[model samples]
Target: MKITKLTKGISLKRPLEGGNEEQLQVVRQVLADVRAQGDAAVRAYTEKWDGFTLQELRVSTEEIEQGAKSLDPQLYADLKEAAHNIRFYHEQQKRSGYRVQLANGSWLGQRITPLDAVGLYVPGGTAAYPSSVLMNVIPALVAGVKRIVLTSPAGRDGQLPTGVLAAAHILGITEIYKIGGAQAIAALAYGTESIVPVDKITGPGNIFVALAKREVFGEVAIDMIAGPSEIAILADDTAFADEVAADLLSQAEHDALACAILVTTSERLAEEVAQEVEKQVAALPREKVARASIAHFGAIYIADTMADAVEAINSLAPEHLEIMTEQAEQVAEQIRHAGAIFVGRYSSEPVGDYFAGTNHVLPTNSTARFASGLNVDDFVKKTSMVYYSEQTWANHAPKIARLARMEGLEGHARAVESRGWRKGE
Candidate 1:
């Protein structure tokens, strides 16, 4: 890892991947075919990419039960407990409609309604992510979404991962499909012979899945165009170097594009962490991936002061931030931009990734400056409600009309005036 002095306007912003032309063309073609052929297109694509022929698009209830039963006893118990914790945390985010009446007998408010249906895409290429199932599904359930569908690629043996299926079963999700890639996204956005279309889609996948979501966004709402995973640690002299290196490598092992950064006030701590990272990464099973990430994207910055370090971190606006300074909590409170902040040595990044109640799906590629992690709000829609009494309209008609006319919208002005209120009436 390279060490540099912290400077103004420095950033670790990686460019968001928008698939290449060939990939985009392939995604567009798949979406079009899925829309035209429905289940046939999905089956064809699944067989081609996943190497499994699908006799049925939907997973049977019996299969779900069997898969859940097949999980190891301890793992099943852990999933149930994690599901409970996630549900408890998101339940606090549920919202209700509210209205406030004005003195003029008019009312204005907002109504919160859960989406009718939602699709969750769990990636199944290199690894199975049962934790993602717990993170994405629990919030939608808390938001009161009625119909939730899960889709993932099947293995060569024609079965989804037992852990993924077990996680879904624990959450009471019955509608699942053995489909993946751009075709699955298409089927979710547009109804097929067996699968019903959803109002919104969430979860992460490869570049093709991301491109498919982008193409179908107007047809159905999507969570975000997620980039590679990233973590930034802000540590001081009080922080332990070995522990810091472990936390940084946790994300580096995720992808070759994954970024790991450390900003510290102590140069000694920076050097120690770099050495520890090099020594520890050699032992990981995913050593090749982690080594590539650390070699290309990993770095340590030496800040003259703690304030400068925090400022630099704010500019980076990392997806996951760990503050391991003397006053970790105080330093975290000063942070203005981060998808999620883990304070102190005990709150490691993986805690939030797996067992912690906080949602792990977060903004990436510096988008935390404006975006947020997935939450209950993502599964619900807010509709503004306005009720104007005749007297209230009579009082404000002229002003409303005048404002409309100022924008050079004659039709809008006429529509407001057409409410039948005249001057001096």
Candidate 2:
């Protein structure tokens, strides 16, 4: 990681994708086949890929009840606590439509409506993430979505992750399927004999799943086309160098492709954090993956001033941002964009990732400029409206007619004129 002169602006790195044209073509074929054959195609793919024979794609209430009961009592309690916090975090973002009446007597307002159903794709590769199940479903539930369907790949024994089942049970979501990957996305997008189609899809998965969602986006709404997880820390002399290094290493531990960087104005802090990073990287269980990520895309920059540091931070617009600096709040205010901001020394990025209540599912790859973190707003839609009283119409008919006619839209003008106010009758 080089601390070079901050002259050239940060260049965009193409975040890695699921696969090349060959793999995408396969995904397209699978989606097409599933769309054509429905349940049989899905089951066949399940057997061939996941190695589990799923006679019934839908998970039953008995299974969920047994799975939840089988979990260690403490684990169930924790998932419940996390679910409550996640629900509370998203609850604040819920919005409602309102009707407004003008002085003249016409009423108009915007209406907010929740989608009927959403398919949440929970990835089961490597390990199941019940946290993801909580993050994706709670928002839609808080938004009052009527139906929340979930799909995840099963193990060789054809079992859903116990933690995932426990979390869903806590959330009161009974609809889940033993499916995963692009195939599951396909089934949800196109509908099958067992898997019901949904209005929207949201979750994180491997490249194949990401690309599958990307391909199906037009047919069904998608939360985001996510890339690898990333985190950036901006620090000053007041910051704890070791803590910064640890936080960066946390995201790096996620995968070899994950990115973690530090940008600061303090040369001493930068060097110390660099050394701490080396010291900590060796001890991590995921050290190899962290090392590769750090070696490839990770960097530490020593900016000439805090403003320069801020400039670099905004340029990255990382998925998770930590401000561990003197006047951290001031730095936070200067930050123009980020998926989520961890404001002080005590608030590490992982806290939000797991327990701190804010959403860990967020826009990656400088998407913060135009995107937002996952919230209740993601699950709802708003439609705008307006109305005017008869008196109000008569009061402004001439101007309306003049503008309509001026635009060469006589029909629009006549529509107003036919009201009988234009001729003052």
Candidate 3:
């Protein structure tokens, strides 16, 4: 980790990886094939990419139960507990329709409706993420979404990971599919013979999956174009160098492109954390990935003051931010642009990632400037409703017609005036 002095106009933005033309072309072709050939194309792509012949696209209830049962009792219990925590938190975000009565005997309101169905893509080549199952599904369920479909690539043994199955089972999600990559995205966006199209899609995946989501965005709603994981720690001399280094590596090990940054007012702490990160990276299981991330994107910045450090963090707009200073909560209050804020040493980034009941699906890149983490709102639609009584329309028709005419829309003005009010009457 290299150390630098915080300066004005410094940006921590990583170059977003929009898939190259070759990848995009592949994704486009897959999407078209799936739309045309339906189940055949899905099966062909699953065999080519996942190396498994699909006996069935949808996983059977028996298989789901068996896979879930295969998990160790303790692990299954822990997953259920995590699911409970996530459900409890997202329950607060559930919404209901609202209407406001007006003085003119008319009403304006919003109708909240859950999407009919949603697709959740779980990545499944090298790792199993049961936590993602909980994070994505619980919010949609809380929002009263009835149909939820889950898709993941099967392993060489032609089976989904037991932990992933167990988590979905805990959530009572039985609509599971054994397919992945761009093809799975295509199947979700456009209905195949075996799969029904969904109103929205959510979750994280590789470059191909990301590109597929981008390609089919307007056809169906998508959660976000999530980038790699990131963590930016705002620490001072009061923070522990070892703990700070550990938190940074938690995100660094996620991908070679993952970013871990330390912004500190104490130069000594900066030096110690940089050294500590190097020492810790050596011991990680994903050391190669962590080393590459640290070498490329990780850094320690020495800020002249705490205010300068906070300003730098806001500019970065990190996916995950941790404050471990003398008054971590107070420092966190000044932050305005993080996807999720973890205050104090105890609130490490992974706590929110797993058991803290906060959704781990967060906006990446600098999108935290405008985007938000997944919640109940993402799975539902808010439709604005308006009702005008005849008397109310008569009272305001002239002004409405005048406003419409100001925009040079003769048809709009005529539509408002066609209610049979004579001129000057």
Candidate 4:
């Protein structure tokens, strides 16, 4: 990992910023082909990418049930338990519509409702994330989404992951398909013969998936164009080196492009954390990916003061941040950015990733400034609804008419004037 004294007013460009773009154009082409040919195009792309020649795009009910039965009983139990907890958490976020009456008898408020059908694209093949099934489905289920479909690439065995199927059983998710990449996204956006079009799509995937989501924004609502996982730690002299190293490695293990950085005022702590990372990383099973991530993207920036450290962290706006300073709580208050904040050594970034009752899907690539981590709010929609009585119409009709005429909108003025009320003195 690179070690340098943290500099104020200096910005470090992310290495992923200069990544390959030829692949992006290919993904766009795949999306366009799928959009034009529908399922036929998707089937060809699936064979090209996942090496699967599917007889059917949609998975069978028996296959899902058999998948559940194939998994370890204990893991199946755990998946159900996790689903319960996630559903309970999201249920609390379910919003209801309310009517607010004005003094003139006008009523207006927001009506919160769920999307009719949604698709969750889980990363498949090399990486099968059943945890993601729980994370994405629970919120939609709680939001009253009736039909939640799932799509993932089929394995070489010509079947989906058992764990993924078990998660579906726990959540009662019926609709699923053996499809992936940009083509799958296009099929979901513009429905095929077998696959139904969904109101929205959520979950994470590779660069191709992100670009496809960006392209299909108007056709179907997407969650976010998620980037690689990243973690940034701001620690002072009081921080524990071991804990800091573990937190950094947690993110680094996600992929070779994943970034983990440390910004601190204490030179001694920075050196200690670097050494600890080296020792700890060797023990991880994904040591190769972690080491590559640390070597290429990881860094320790030693700031002269705490304020400088805080400023640098804010500018970076990492997906996950940990403050292990003496005033970790105080530092948290100064922080105006970051997808999620972990205070003190015990509240490490990984805690929020699993079993911490917080959604781990976070914004990356300096997007924390405007975007937010995945939450129950992502699954629901709010529509502003209004009702007006005759007295209320009388109360505000003239003002509405004047404003409409001032704007040269006779139709708008007549709509108000057609209320059949006399103009008062």
Scored by TM-score, the top model is 3
Per-residue lDDT tens digits for candidate 3, residues 1-425, read: 99998997788645367879999999999999999999999999988988879889989999899989999999999899999999999999987999999867999999999999999999896689999999999999999999999999989778899999999999999999999999999999998989999999999999999999999999999999998999999998899999999999999999999999999999899889888998998999999999988888888999999999999999999999999998888989999999999999899999999998999999999899999999999999999999998788888999999999999999998997887756554
- For model 3 the local lDDT of residue 328 reads 85
Q: Runs in model 3 with CA error above 4 Å?
A: 13-15, 421-425
Of the pair 2 and 4, which is ahead by TM-score? 2
Which runs in model 1 stand beyond 4 Å of their true positions?
Answer: 13-16, 421-425
TM-score of 2: 0.94
lDDT of 2 by residue, 1-425 (tens): 55655544865332564579988998898899999999999898889888878888889999998889989999899888888888788888888899988787888899999999999989894587989989999999999999999999989889898888988899899999999988999999999887779989999988889889999999999999888889999888999888989998999888788988888888898889889999999999999998988888788887888888788888888899999988789889999989999999999997898777788889987889899988888788889988887888888888998999999999988888688755678
Q: How accurate is candidate 1 locally (lDDT)?
A: 0.92
Clashing pairs in model 2? 18-207
TM-score of 1: 0.97
Could you tell me which 10 consecutive residues in candidate 3 have the lowest summed lDDT?
416-425
**Each prediction's TM-score versus the true structure:** 0.97, 0.94, 0.98, 0.93
Model 1 C-alpha lDDT per residue in residues 51-101, reported as the tens digit of each score? 878998888999999999999999999999988888889999888999999
Q: Which of 1 and 4 is ahead in lDDT? A: 1
Model 2 spans with C-alpha error above 4 angstroms? 12-19, 421-425
Error of 1 at 92 (Å): 1.7
Clashes of each: 0, 1, 0, 0
Assess each prediction's global lDDT (C-alpha) against the native: 0.92, 0.87, 0.93, 0.85
